[model samples]
Target: MTPDLADGGAASAAPSPAAAERAARAPLMSVRNVTKVFGRDVVALRGMSLDVRQGDFISLLGPSGCGKSTALRLIAGLSNPTSGRIEWAGGGRTDADLGVVFQEPTLMPWATVAKNVWLPMRLRGKSFASCRADIEDALETVGLKGFEGAYPRELSGGMKMRVSIARAMVTRPKMILMDEPFAALDEITRFKLNNDLLAMRAKLNCTVIFVTHSVFESVFLSDRIVVMAARPGRVIHELNVDEPYPRAEIFRTSAEYAAQCRAASEALNEAMGGAGAGHE
Candidate 1:
């Protein structure tokens, strides 16, 4: 699953055995020399490549102009690369095998929570009645069991995000693409949602490709951080957390987390100096 090779990644130290082992596995999907340009002059991403193995939790970390969201969109098939390819191991697949969660809840305000979660399944030709149990379980999984009948307008921001995540999970997609899903929430709420996300990931046993600008959040939630640079955004470094799952508040305050964050911060600092400016 080793995603970044540019700059040989920014780790001052060696990866843990666990992380190395993980990197050696077969990739579920691979992006080779991907590039996306907004127009004639604006280059969003350039020659970006990465490998995503099954059950991996990867975070694309960088500054605002870095191609993190663009990368996610490519992975979700919501957009296409200017000149590159994304290949899945088992050959071609349908949209049903993928899920996406945007920064905003983006729920249908007119629909109830249950109905919102049922949208994906419905789009695939299943009726609400047919997937009622799956919908209920998805809601409960996100800690919104009793709010099924509630409308988006009636729910809090965190609850609305829960609905969004539930909808993504309901499809049991092999991989979920999340674009700063908790970025707008307050710190306390964001922390809770982070924990909830890890727990739900464990229960669902699905891969996640998350886009975020938060170093601490990425360290706590991701096993691998694909560091990117702007000005024709591209991978600059890749750091592996190597910590086992079920990360908790204790882990948050641990020395390991702080060290990883510092390393990532340093790599990010150098990239912000425009490391990608002269590169294609």
Candidate 2:
């Protein structure tokens, strides 16, 4: 769970140097000086280095084609980086405990929501009887408790996404890699899911690496936002969000939030080669 915010709505005090050093040594997952090249001509990631601490909510924000999805794919072990190494805390290369959610729900249309959510566990040779309790709990956690028997064709986009999230959580993953999971939802649904996601994160305490193009979403959801450049995707800036979790709607309208959003926009603009130029 997120550390409780101290009084005055600031992040808790930084850990002691020794503790920080120890944490630096203990990465749930570390992308160490990684690089990915699509072909002889195109470079996707250029020596990107990031340490994802346990339970962190880090967002990679950039323009389209900035390698954000590529980064997630590498971390998911769906694709290998052309160069550099990814080290897990317990020391291994491939992904065994990670959960991934793509932009689309990718649910089997013929299956009930409960059955869809149970697919991951079923693939691991566990029976429905063995995971029935977990399935119910996961559905409830994602706010789809009563819709278990509903089919994908009967659910709206937001509801389908909720099912996708439930499936990702059912396995109790150590980390979740989400690639613009809410990009297709309507504004109201998007905001609702954003709030729900934060609440779920607080309760589950799983590390999240979310990819998004929305500056506001990144500012509202992230503990740290990594802005990346497009042409050979690389981290241009790392912005720390000091706001406490369970942030109120009032905080969204506050000057502090606006300032952070503006900073992120500026960083994005610069990454997109618009330094000193107006941003959209």
Q: Which predicted model would earn the best lDDT? A: 1
On residues 1-280, what C-alpha lDDT tens digit does candidate 2 reach at each position? 1112111123324644433443453368889999999979698888999988887789999987788989999898888989899888887733337777889998999999999999989999889989999999999999998998899999999999999999998888889889999998999999999999998888888889999999999989987789887878888777777676777667779887887787777778777877644333
What TM-score, computed on C-alpha atoms, does each candidate reach?
0.92, 0.89
As for candidate 1, its clashing pairs are none
Best by TM-score: 1
What lDDT is reached at residue 240 by model 2? Answer: 70
Tell me the lDDT of candidate 1: 0.87
How many clashing residue pairs appear in each of the predictions shown? 0, 0
Model 1 off-target regions past 4 Å?
A: 1-17, 274-280
Error of 1 at 200 (Å): 0.4
Query: Against the unseen true structure, what C-alpha lDDT does each candidate score?
Result: 0.87, 0.83
lDDT of 1 at 17: 72
lDDT of 1 by residue, 1-280 (tens): 2334332344325666766767676778999999999979799999998999988999999988889999988888888889999899899658888888999999999999999999999998998899999999999999999998999999999999999999999999989999999999999999999999999999998989999999999999998889998887998887778778878889899888887887777777766764444433
